[model samples]
Target chain A: MTHPKTRAPRVARIAGLVLVLLTAVSGCSSPQKWDLTNITGIMPQLKFTLTDQDGKTLQASDLRGKIPVLYFGYTNCPDICPTTLATLAQALRKLGAEANAVRILFVSVDPARDTTAVLKSYVQAFGPQFIGLRGDQKELRYLTKRYRVTYGLGKADAHGNYEVSHSSAVFVFDRKGDVRLLGRGTDPAKSYTHDLKQLINDN
Target chain B: MQRIHWQKHVSISGTHGRGSMMLALLLSCAVANAAPVPSVVITQARVRLLPGNLPLAGYFTLTNDGSAPVTLTGAISGSFKQIMMHRSFESDGMSKMAPVAKLTIQPRKSVHFRPGSYHLMLMGRQQSLSVGDTVPIQLQFKNSGALTVEFKVVPVGAQ
Candidate 1:
C-alpha cells in the first residue's frame, strides 16, 4: 500500500540497523590483544602420540578444544624444571576457575629414566591438573625436532650419575590447537596469567 | 649476644641524632671485631624435595666477612648420600647443569646460590623427606674451614 519511494527508505534503514548490529557482534567476538609473541602461521607440527602419566596412549588431537601449555623436561631435573613447573602452577592458580579449561602437558625428554609412574608423581607434585607425557626415542626425536627443542644427555660418571639437558621454554597453544605464544621459564607469573587470560578470552 | 650489643649501640646513638656518624663508625668496628675464623655466614638455606629418589636442589646465600677470599670446595649432607656443587644455566633455550669445581667469594662479598645459577645437587636421599623437615649440611671451604648449617626442606616448586 505504501509508495515505492517511501518503502525504499524504510528498507534501507532496516538494512542499516541490521548491518550495525552485525558489526557490533563481530567486534565483540574478535580475538583479544595478546602480549606474547604471535606464531600462528609459523607453528610446527603439533601432532603427537605419546604415553600419558596413566600409562594410556594419548593423541595430541585429544586436547584440541583446550589451550595447552607444553614444557619439555625430565623428572630428575632439579632446578629449571621444578622452577618452570612452579611458575606455571602459580600462573594457573591466578587464573582460578578458568584454569580448568587449560591443559599443562609436561613432556619428559628422558623416557628411559622417567617411567609413567615416576612422571605422574613428578608432575602431580606441581599440580593435580598437570599431565605428564613420555615417548620413545624415535617419537621424541620427531616431536622435539618439529618443535625445535634441543636436548642432549650428559656424560655419566663412574658412579652412573648423569644429567639430561633439555629445553626450558613453555610453548602455548590456543583453544583451536594452534601455536600462539612462547613463554620463557624466567617470565613472571603475572605475565603468564595475563597471556593465558587473553587467550582464554579470545575465540 | 653480639647482635644485641650492636642493636643497643645503634639505638642509643639514634637517641642523639647528631651521633649518627659515630654509629656508622661503631658498626664498622663491630663488624671487624666480630670476624671469627671461617667468617662465612650462610642464610636462607633451603632444599627442594623432589619426588621419589630424585636428586634435590639446594639454594642459599653465603656471605664472607673475613680478610681473605674463600673458596667453597664441596658440601656434605647427612640426609643425602652425595652432595655436589652444580651450576644450572639456560643457553639457546636448553637447560644445562654442569658440575662446578669451586666457588670463590672475595672478602666482604656475598654469593647467592639461586635456582638458575649455582646450586648444590643433593643426590640419593637416605630417607624420605617432606616439607618443613630440616637437613644438616656442611660446607667445606678452602680457607674458611667447614661450616655446618641446617637446610630446610621446601616444596619442589619453591623459588
Candidate 2:
C-alpha cells in the first residue's frame, strides 16, 4: 500500500512539472498579436527595382538592413496620398529616433506626371526617412504584379488633369526584406506605431 | 415607432453633448413644420493644407435644420483657383477619389465632410496660406442660395 501511494504521488508531481514546462514553451513560441494585419507568411518577400528621388536606381537588396514600407501613390493626389503619408509621419514621430530604422517608400504609379523632381519635393515634405520611387511602366508592372495590386488612370480632361486610382494598402517589410504586416490608409496612426515598434524589435 | 425614433435621437444627442441636444430639439421642431425653413449651419470647418502649393482638402459639418432636404451643389473659394467636391472611397485595398456632382442632406440630418469621405478638393492656390489662417469658402446649395463659411487652415496631419 505504501509503495503504490508513493508512486502515485510521484507520477502526479511529474505530470504537473511537465504541464508547467509545456505552458512555458507555448508562451515562448506563440505568435504575437499585431495591431496591423499579420501577413508574415501570406505574401512574398520584398522585391523591387525603382528609381529613388535622386534618380539613382535601387533594388530590393539595397534596402536589406532597414524596414521598408511600400506605398503606391502619385504626387498630385490631393487628399488620400498626403493624408496617408502624414499619418505615417505621425507614427514615426511617435517612435522618435527609432524611426531611423524605418523607410517609407512612396512609389509613384503615375510616372508620366510625377517626375523625379516632383517626387523628391513631394516626399521630402513628409520626412527624411521618406524615399520617393518612380519606375517605368514595365518596372512598375513587375513590382505591382508581384504584390497583386493595381493602378488605373482616368481620361484626362481638357486641362490635362486626370484621376488616379492606386493601391491604398501599406506593405510593411522587416529588416530582412520579408513582407510582414499589411496596413491600410484609413488605419489610425497608433496602429502603425504599435506594429512598427514590434517589427523593429523583431529579430 | 415615433417615440422610439425620438428616443434614439435623444441618445445620439447625448453623445454629442448639450449643444447638439438643443440642435436636435430645434431639428425636431422644424421637422414638424412648427417653424420656417431653418438655415443650414456650418460648423467645425477646416482646411488641410500641404506644402509647396500642393492641393488641399476641406472638411466641415453641415447641419440641415430645415424640414425639406437640401442639395449641396458645390463650393467656391477666393483662396483657391478651383474647388471641387470629391469623395474618397476604398475598394479591395484601392483608394479612389471621384467627383461628386451633388449631395443631398435629409431633413434634420447632418452631413460631415471628413477625410476618407466627402471633402472639398481645393487646388491651384491663388494665395499662400499658413496654419491658423482662416479662408472664406462659399458653399452653394440648390434652392437655398449660398453661405460663406470661414475655414481655418490646418497642417497636413491635422486629422
Candidate 3:
C-alpha cells in the first residue's frame, strides 16, 4: 500500500502535467497578432500541381520546406498584377537574407496569353524568388476553388485583347505549406514584412 | 497654344486680414481671362513597362487650370498600337479593371491616374521600350485640342 505522503506527491505531479498541457493547448488556440489577416488553420494547406515557368511540372511538395506567397494574376494584366508583385518584392527586400527562404507563386489566370516563356520573364523581373505558374482551366479552377478565390476572363475585344479579373488576396503559407496569413495587393510593404519575419522566426 | 499667366499679386499668408479677400478677387479676375491659362496640365507622367510586350500602365495627374471643365476622351502613342483608359478597383474581394470611356476633370481640379486607380493600359507595343525611355502620348480631350505629354518609362517596380 502506498503511503499517504507519497500519494500527495503523485497528485501534485499530475496537476503539474495538466497545467503544462493546458498552456500548450491555449497557445495553439490563441490568435496571433499579425498585421495581415491571420488565416491560420482557416484555409487548407497549399496543394497544387501546375506548370512552372520552366515548363516543368511542379508539385506542392517541391516547396515543402519553403514559405510560399501565392497570388493569382496574368501577364497581360497592366495594373494589379504588377503592382501586387512589386509590393511583394518590396516586402521581400526588407527581409534581407531571410527572403531567400520565401517563394512567390504567381499563378496566371489567363493561361492562354501567359505562356511559359512570357511568365518566366515576367516573374524574373520582379525577383529571383518569384515563380510564375500556369495551369489549364481544369487545374486552375480546381486550385482556385480550393482557396475560395475566383478568376474570370472578360470578352476579347476586336484586337484580341481581353481583361482578366482575379482575387487580389495574397496568401502566405508557412514552411509546412499551411495557409497562415491573407493580405491584399494594396497593403503596405511593411505589413507583409512584419508578418513574414514573424512567420519565418516562428517556424 | 495660348497660356494663362497670373500677373496679379496674391497674398498667401493667413495672418493678413485681407489675404482671403484678395485671393478671391484675384481668382475672379483670372477666371475672366482663363483662356490664356492652359486648360489641362499633365504632371508626374510615367509609364510602367512590364516584361516582354505585356500591357503597361501609365500614371499621371491631369490638372485643369482653366475655368471650364475638360474631358479626357482617350490617349494615343506611337510606341503602342492600342491605348485604353482603365480603372482598377476591388469589389466583392476581387480585383477588377473596367474600361473608362471618358473622364471629366472639373475646373481647377485634378484627376490622378495612378496604380490601383485610373490608368492608361498601353498594349501591343510597336517599338521596344526600356527604362528611362520617354514615350510621347497625346492626350485626346473633348472640345479642347489634344496635348502631347511625354511619359517616362519606369521599371515594373515603379508605383
Q: Evaluate model 2: give its TM-score.
A: 0.82
Worst 10 residues of 1 chain A by lDDT: A31-40
What DockQ class does candidate 3 belong to? Answer: medium
Candidate 1 residues lying further than 4 Å off, grouped into runs, are: A1-32, B1-36
TM-score list, all predictions: 0.83, 0.82, 0.83
Model 1, B45-114: lDDT tens per residue?
Answer: 9999878999889999988777889999999978888998999887987889889999899999999999
Standalone chain B TM-score for every prediction: 0.75, 0.76, 0.76
Question: Model 1 has how many clashing residue pairs?
Answer: 0
Candidate 2 CAPRI-style tier? acceptable
DockQ of each: 0.61, 0.48, 0.68
**Using DockQ as the measure, which candidate wins?**
3
lDDT values for all models: 0.84, 0.87, 0.90
How would you encode candidate 2's per-residue C-alpha lDDT over A35-111 as one tens digit per residue? Answer: 89988888899998899999999899999989999999988888899889999999999999999999999999999
What are the runs in model 3 whose C-alpha is more than 4 Å off? Answer: A1-31, B1-38
lDDT of 2: 0.87
Model 2: per-residue Cα lDDT over B107-152, one tens digit each: 8899999988999988889998999999999888887667778899
Q: Which ten residues in a row have the lowest lDDT in candidate 3 chain A?
A: A31-40
